[model samples]
Target chain A: MTGAPQDPADAEACPVAPTLWLRLEADGTYRVGLTTTAARRAGAIVHYRGPVAGRAYAAREPAASLESEKWVEHLALPLPGTVVEVNPLPTADPGLLNRDPEGAGWLCRVLAGPTDGRAAPPSVPTGAPE
Target chain B: MSLEPSDEARPGRLPSWRLLDLGRCAPARAQAFVEAVAVSVGEGRVPNTLVLAQPSAPYLSLGFHQSFHEELDPGFLERRRIPVLRRVEGGGTTYLDPDQWFFQLAYRDEGGGRGGPEDLKRFLRGPVAAARSLGLSAELRAPSDLVVGGRKVSGNAGGDWEGAHLVVGGFLLGADVRAMADALRLPHPALRPLLRGLVAREVTSWEEAVGVRPPWERFRQALASAIATEGRFEARTGAPTPAEEARFLEETLPRHSDPAWRELPPAPRRAGSLVRRLRIAGPHGLLVFRGSGEHLAAIVDGDRLVEAYRVGDGPTDALEELGEDGDGRAAVAELVASTPSFA
Candidate 1:
């Protein structure tokens, strides 16, 4: 979500639930973050927990939790992987997720284990990596 | 987070809504039951469902994101022996007792709303209709509120739970303004009366609006019918599936019982000076004020800078309109010193 190539371009494309994305890094690591729709629906981010750095998750398994003005729910990972690099900003100040969700607010970096990325939610858009 | 349903759904006909009327449950159980429903719906164990229930005792249910310390006065809660729990949904902090009848809805994504405007409409339509069914003129205040006249009759909040959408709100069958104020950690003593007056003025219930508290069975029947009609679902009396029941006892009840869980999510360490904004005498205006002893800054009618005596921990330059002389400014600040008002 933060610094990777993800999909679901804008707010209008998102609904109440978070529309998430998985961006594969050059080193084959992966990043997961929600789009603007989830951030906006969340209103101001009050608290956020980054995915655990070493926890392995099955594909589409929720990796973290967040609370906004709306509801508290887990942030699911679209790919099966072991969490590697946890973004520090949103962990310290959850508001970053609202301000720059697609950039600094990306949930975590994961070392992809398996799956061809077919497990992502149906509406996830494709993004060109920066 | 997953629960097994007692029965699988019929193959052909699907209910637009499944109704569960939990007439009276222990205070904590009443509040936590909805989480069970949400988990069931999210996991496909149950379809869209609506639940009606009331807590036998009084307690404070805070929003998921609300800071427990900032929103509550611990001394008061301890004195009253009231247990506080953080609800899964988000919104304002609320006080609940047996007199209040609550409504909760869990909708799966099959044909459900995606959140935002559509969700708000879906959230309040049934409650608004139920209020009207009782012969009160009720309408929705955007995002989530059921208002009658200009006062809010119901407090509501909605959001996604796993793969399902959940909305929880309630109508006060009685008014307890003083208790409501006493429970809050007021920023100032003066705001005490203001909050009392504000809650009494802005929040209304069946007892206050109608001559009598709405008869229990009658009101709930109307609620079920109205909710079913709004969603175009058939209303039928149903009990919680074994899974929902199991989770309520095994999970939610125990978690809410733990005192640490009540204060589990801490509030922010430092907060900016907050403004207390309350509706003024007129419907179109607001009185927004912020300050501490001897100094205050206020904005009346939204734009007028009525006074600028304080901001953060110290006094600032007073409004020039009152004159640059310290004497004149001090005189004005003292006149409205105790509370922010129009005159």
Candidate 2:
């Protein structure tokens, strides 16, 4: 699979936080998606979830959501940042990730950096890999 | 500001938060009340609050994540004066009436944690504190329920909004235990245990608690005190903003009351199974079946002809199909007929 395109123009687009397990690739790019730990705690995936383009998100805020059979849970941002790119397909069929989470399930991309310089996103605690 | 000063300098105790006693409104109104309260707080138009409303007639209420069939006899409820309504939160079934005083709290999600457990704890403390304000000792046992002296007084449930707005509420007024027991179709396993032991332990009301019918004023006083102390509310009254009201009505209300939305099971494979011969006969002839746990898939007509077969291995689709238009049997028949010939 081709690596996600890196665009300097995308970097300054809008801010979003990582709602699941995600990080910045060493080449100054972002890799954001849901964590396995979060999936189990939420029970089962039942409905649609995705993100909005051109919208800024704070760290730990939900840019998207996944519904279980009974309840729907939001995927919070892992790091404070901006959305530079988004895969529109997941919103139509969120279960894709819930079913085969490790691949083809990545939710969105964000330009990682604190907007307004309030505070950096909280680092995931040890053993917090859910 | 000075820590202490003359009478003018010292702020007097705030008056108790005003309570809107919705005395026996129609089922629709009871629902409207919930929507009004939720929309008001959810959109930040209203501060934290305690809303007490009593529907004039009986109604079956289901939690956000609850299945309608699990708790209510829809036909029976419809036949009777009761209305079957759904709420925008999670929890078990609650049977409501004039004798019961419904308590609701729409508040900001200020809990120090996140997810179900965090929200549950944050929401529960409000009512327990309310009960305490009313002069009753209350405690939150394991999970997300409130109890007084081993007997449950209130049950609470709600979801986190952006991990910010969380609405948690329950019934504190007296419940008609026998009627509720009868109206609700408790899952057999749960019922069997209740019939045997916990049933006796589950107590119902202020009457049971204080050995007399609780004075409405007293209950109100207690509820107000608790909410004022533990929750946040402005001393103003008005309808929720149009945007918030529209959202609740559009997004929240329909999701709750629609049977198709309410009873849709999460997964078809996990459904339970049972076969019962209704007294009424059907054109398809006598039915017999082999089903997956709870889903009816293949059935034999009177002559033992395989009349129905579901194409899928599990009941996920069946969950959505169950109560919709009340065509569970037809869907079952369709499922059976559609199955591959070998099975």
Candidate 3:
């Protein structure tokens, strides 16, 4: 549903994926952004590499790469999809993923399909925060 | 030109010495090769000495416990079109291209000889002697690096699994120095220049540096000679054995390419969350409590609250999501609390 697009001015004031950011675009595609906790758990986001456009990726295929200050990580997709477009600039500079994860740092755009119930969001029950 | 008996060199004979040539194949095959070897050695069906050559591919490898996000700029890597690969062994990061020749040596040894001169001497002898047999005059430097004329041409690392050892190394055979330096997250400011110097001082490839197209057979012979292995070396040329196949899938596959493993634990041990979904009987019977960012988000202990702490975003959601099972919640909360911005 198209609610009034959150104002850029308002978005700047709002916290970004404080717990975790999950987005379901108008086309029924879901995008999940890491909470700062997730990012921190992943170390520093040093690099963000995404799939090429027009390529179909299986669920849990590496969706992106993250190189934090301490290590290098591959971010796997939870669902299958065709890579529609990648965040162009972030591939040239990975710090954006670490610094602005939900904004300019968002890694890839996938036209995702259901995973036949094989994969669910990691088992984090609602109301229980760790 | 056939060599006379007097001109022939004596080959080193090491019982476990085995060499594998993976004729042009995908990167996954290389991974599978190592896993197969690991399984064979683990089961006592094979000796420890195994050498595997990874075919050319656009791949980057990271050490065990290294985080992808922490060490590299994913954007830069993507722009250059390099795929990141995680290997079974532990070490720092490395880059592998078609021009590069990758070699892994699997030995069966526990940590008894680890960090000892004998282990280092044994590990370096194969590659070092191989290089010399090819007439390159290479030598082993301190630690594990191999230096040829003062330049480093190879880097090595290994770990033991169930009394079986796996040591793998990479030889820069006509590798792109600028590309490798660019790809890895280096620890020292001087790494690039130092690596360039090391490459110059240590390694000589068949195509460019050696002035001769050293065929793959030459590499194999050199390796065999160094290790004193006299057995008839043949290419594996087939799929892994069933037992090997199963063990590789079980022990190496999941962690090989998984991002969760690539991104290691973020917090110090104490700061790590102790997530628990199921009931636990500590001071009281089956105490249930929800926590957030190191504080108790909510508590319900057998219909009464014995203790409670502040419920932040972390503890509140973790408790609810982890309902009944009581898994890794506490660790997550403590980790979240220690983060810089959370305070």
Candidate 4:
């Protein structure tokens, strides 16, 4: 019955995007994931294959593949960057992507340059509400 | 990019899409052909395509994400000499035979404008209209299901394959409910009849819906023509390229046939000897529960009881208890309460 925490820190911690949830960490790496809305829309995720950690990708390129009961989608990286780490939890139990998309359900962490100076943002938009 | 009609286009004319009519082939070949088209289309070598095919023999097909061990009884499949393969698109386990007509559409993913969800809705509309044109009151359900009078007639799944967006679905002309029930790994032996009844109640076929079984040729042409008219596509019949066929024989079939691809990792070990694991169709979704002596793990997904706990020490004893009052849910709840709640 209670509302989710409205703290700015928590809000800034995980910003919502059209297709994914983005979290800007202090270490400068961005933790990216398929938003809970997107996850549920795709149905229960039953399998996942993520890009290898340390692999660099161009913006809009596929970084991970997710499969649910009724659909399969490839999540593209929003920015050009090298993947620092990929979450192991969803690989073993893909349902975690639906259960806790912003927490244990994160897909990967990428090290990218600052976004403020960029002329165009990533192909997918960011900053929507979760 | 500005939107404009091509110079080659005449007034009220739309682009033509190729249709591959791969009539009755081995189940593995059918799966392989779809994959080949996805690859070819994604590479921009082939035009946006609609593939129509059916399996010459019966086989079990698993969703891209499903674990074979969890969804199927391998011994039954083996005894029946039914080959099993995983598809690139997502959906639950299904039995495919010559009776069902498979349709797969693959097109280029034009970024922006329409997203995956919207595209699925648009893609399914043509087929739904086609079914309705046959005098069946079919409707499109969310996420891509075609239902008639509240029972499912067609099930669909879609995904992106490299640069192509693909949706694969099928219309059931007829089905073997008993074979389907036997193939799946139900929790208890006594549940087979229940599973058969459940499947019959939940699913429908062309014969069941229309009270007459239309010829395969007639149904195929009707669906193809209807889709062509609805989508503004000119259907051109074709076949897979020789290269695609070679790839299917060499790469696709062998990889899917691997044993490791079908197995699931071992379950987490817990205290007490494992007694039974039951998968029941609950009111909500699939109920799957496993019990090891006194420990039980129960999980419910949607209307089906996907997971459940063990009611008694053995399968026979559990079936007896389930039959006691003819109430499975109460027995499940009692077992659930007796076991420690992990949540």
TM-score of each: 0.75, 0.54, 0.47, 0.72
Model 4 per-residue lDDT tens digits across residues B1-343:
1113462166665555678888888888766577767666766676678888888989888776555777787668778988888776766778878878888887775321133555666778778887887777788876677888767778788877545678888887786767766788865564455556656666788878898766668767877887777666767777777766776776667766766544423222233332333222212122334545423334433322333433443556543323324355565655554433221
Can you give the lDDT of residue A26 in candidate 3?
63
Best by lDDT: 1
lDDT by residue for model 1 (B1-343), tens:
2222322244544355678888898877777788778777877777678889989998998876565776787768789988788776766678788878888888876645564435756757888888887887778876566777777777777666556778788887886767876787754454445456556776777777876877879988999898877776666677788988887888777767765546644433433333443332222122324434432433343233343333233233332233446664454345334443332
Segments of candidate 1 deviating more than 4 angstroms: A1-18, A26-28, A40-74, A79-99, A111-130, B1-14, B115-117, B267-272, B275-343
Q: Can you give the DockQ of every candidate in the order shown?
A: 0.23, 0.07, 0.02, 0.21
Query: Ten residues in a row with the worst lDDT in model 4 chain A?
Result: A121-130
TM-score of chain B of 4: 0.79
Summarize candidate 3's per-residue lDDT along B109-166 as a digit string, tens digits.
4211332223544666777877777766667764456765555566665543322445
Q: Which portions of model 3 show Cα errors greater than 4 Å?
A: A1-130, B1-17, B109-118, B185-208, B229-240, B249-251, B266-343
lDDT of 2 by residue, A25-85 (tens): 5566476666555555555454444555545666554455555422445455555566666
RMSD of each: 8.0, 13.3, 21.5, 8.4
Candidate 4: where are CA atoms >4 Å away? A1-63, A75-84, A91-104, A109-130, B1-12, B111-115, B264-286, B291-311, B318-343
lDDT, residue B116, model 4: 56
Across B1-343, the per-residue lDDT of candidate 2 in tens digits comes to 1111243233553322224455556665555455555444544454444566666777766654344564465444666756666554554566667766666554544312344445566546766776666556778764555666766666665554433333445555675665655555522222222222322345456656755555666765666655655543323333445665575566555554555544543221222242222100111221223455443433333323333322223423332223324465565655445432211
Worst 10 residues of 1 chain B by lDDT: B279-288
